[model samples]
Target: MLCGGTSAARPATDETQQIADKVKPQIEEKEGKTFDVFNAVEFKTQVVAGTNYFIKVHVGNDEYVHLRVFQSLPHENKPLSLHSYQSSKTKHDQLTFF
Candidate 1:
């Protein structure tokens, strides 16, 4: 058998766009609820296959949050990852990531 380890590649932008297209209805159709980038409280994302990334926005003063939303298993409740946290003196508003 010969070795052929080259894997196929797809554009990341396209994948992200596809996911957004699927979830647009939920974002816009929430009953009387508007997503203000400055006041983002929480977010939800779904993944059928491959990577689906939605951003976590915050509409606060310090702009302490600039994170991307993750696709989690519907049953599992996972906390936000704080791996890239910085040692700043500003207090950041708390927001839940789903």
Candidate 2:
């Protein structure tokens, strides 16, 4: 892929779930609602100075949310942070950079 461009969307893996779990609380707090079913289903990634994870999460029923979680360069010793999110989405929605 072109440098600094987003990668193609792909099925979420264990690592993806782990990343999503780390940022779930932040998302829930902002939305003012907790998600009982927080499962990462699909994702895309953009490599910046660090990496930005664009994830499609299944939050039970027909509800989905797109999350942008940023991970700083390992040596920086920074924790993953929830950069942004889009709620009230569906399973069919494309997981893209936001």
Candidate 3:
């Protein structure tokens, strides 16, 4: 039973790495033009109705870009939905989605 449980967990880790690998370049390309340094700081996963993964990237020293993957139906081959935004110090009247 323990061995089965360990085997089951491997795929989830691999999937998360795959998602990160795919998304990192896109974010780097976009943010690279603006920030001098771009690096991934952390990755967080949330499983609610579906699996959601968040990648936290640091742009320069202060600014940050958040990359989110929303999988409405987990384990589907269809492209996972992606949402990303750069953090701002100034307050905005309205929220923006990208």
Candidate 4:
């Protein structure tokens, strides 16, 4: 990937799921509802001062959501935050920058 450019989308790994899990509560609070199935299905990353994760999540059944999560640099010791999200999605939807 080019410097500061987002990487190509990748299939979600256990580590990716952990990253998604870290920001799940923030997402739930923002949406004012809880998800029964918050599973990371795919992801892309962009390196900034720290890193940005663009993830596709399976909320439950045919429902899905895309999340933009930010993780601060290790030394900063900040918690991951839900930078943005798109709800009411489906499994067929492509995971893109949003």
Candidate 5:
């Protein structure tokens, strides 16, 4: 297995001390709308020099992905090692969030 490296450059940057308002829901939007998601392998970490406030959710697979999703959210009670993954057929079809 090949390990990946990291640097201080991420496309959706929030490096500086700043906060923005969330206008709408991420998964749902009106007509003629689209949202960008990072469907990549080396996407596990988006490290800043010295910070623990950063948050990333890798909801889907990284290697040989049937699906991939990466997003930055404010810190939640959810653990960082914790992820949402289910490979079986029945659970995947029934699972839905709102």
Candidate 6:
């Protein structure tokens, strides 16, 4: 018989931070803006044999950005992947903002 239990949550590891650091510059360049603040909202590991990280960033007044970073398993030796775009519009629409 096998039993499974949830693991305790852990703070962001150095590797995760490094992934964020590596992706931030690209996001800033593509968005043509500087981020005043950035927060990681989600992290998943061993999902689909890789890791995923989601980040929310504030670029300026009423401007918000979301980024997703995917890192393949080390055994695969694949390069990191990233996707980023403005998320505030959707948030506003959902909130019924005019």
Best by lDDT: 2
In model 5, how large is the Cα lDDT of residue 79?
A: 22
In model 6, how large is the Cα lDDT of residue 18?
73
The per-residue C-alpha lDDT of model 2 at residue 71 equals 97
Tens-place lDDT per residue, model 3, 1-98, is 23212111211345565675566666667656645554555555566556666655555656666667666664565666665655542221122223
Ranking by lDDT: 2, 4, 6, 3, 1, 5
After TM-score superposition, the amount by which residue 35's alpha carbon in candidate 6 deviates from its true location, in angstroms, is 2.0
The sequence of per-residue lDDT tens digits that candidate 1 reaches over residues 1-98 is 11222122222354444443444335435423443433323332334332223333333455433234345455666533222211111334332222
Number of backbone collisions per candidate: 2, 0, 0, 0, 0, 0
- Cα error, candidate 5, residue 61 (Å): 18
RMSD of 5: 14.1
lDDT of 2 by residue, 18-92 (tens): 999999899989999888999999999999999999999999999999999999999999999999999989988
Give the lDDT of residue 31 in candidate 2.
Answer: 93
Better of 3 and 6 by lDDT: 6
State the lDDT of candidate 6 residue by residue for 1-98, as single tens digits: 11222123334466656776678788778767667655443233334457555544344566655556777889999877775444663223221111
Which parts of model 2 have CA positions greater than 4 angstroms off? none
> Model 6 compared with the native: what TM-score?
0.53
Q: Model 4: per-residue lDDT, tens digit, 1-98?
A: 99988899999999999999988889899999998889999999999999999999999889999999999999999988889999998888887776
Give the candidate number with the greatest TM-score: 2
**Candidate 3 weakest ten by summed lDDT:** 3-12
* Global Cα lDDT for candidate 6: 0.53
- TM-score for predicted model 1 compared with the true structure: 0.27
**What are the lDDT figures for the candidates, one per model?**
0.34, 0.94, 0.52, 0.91, 0.25, 0.53
Model 6 weakest lDDT span, ten residues long: 89-98
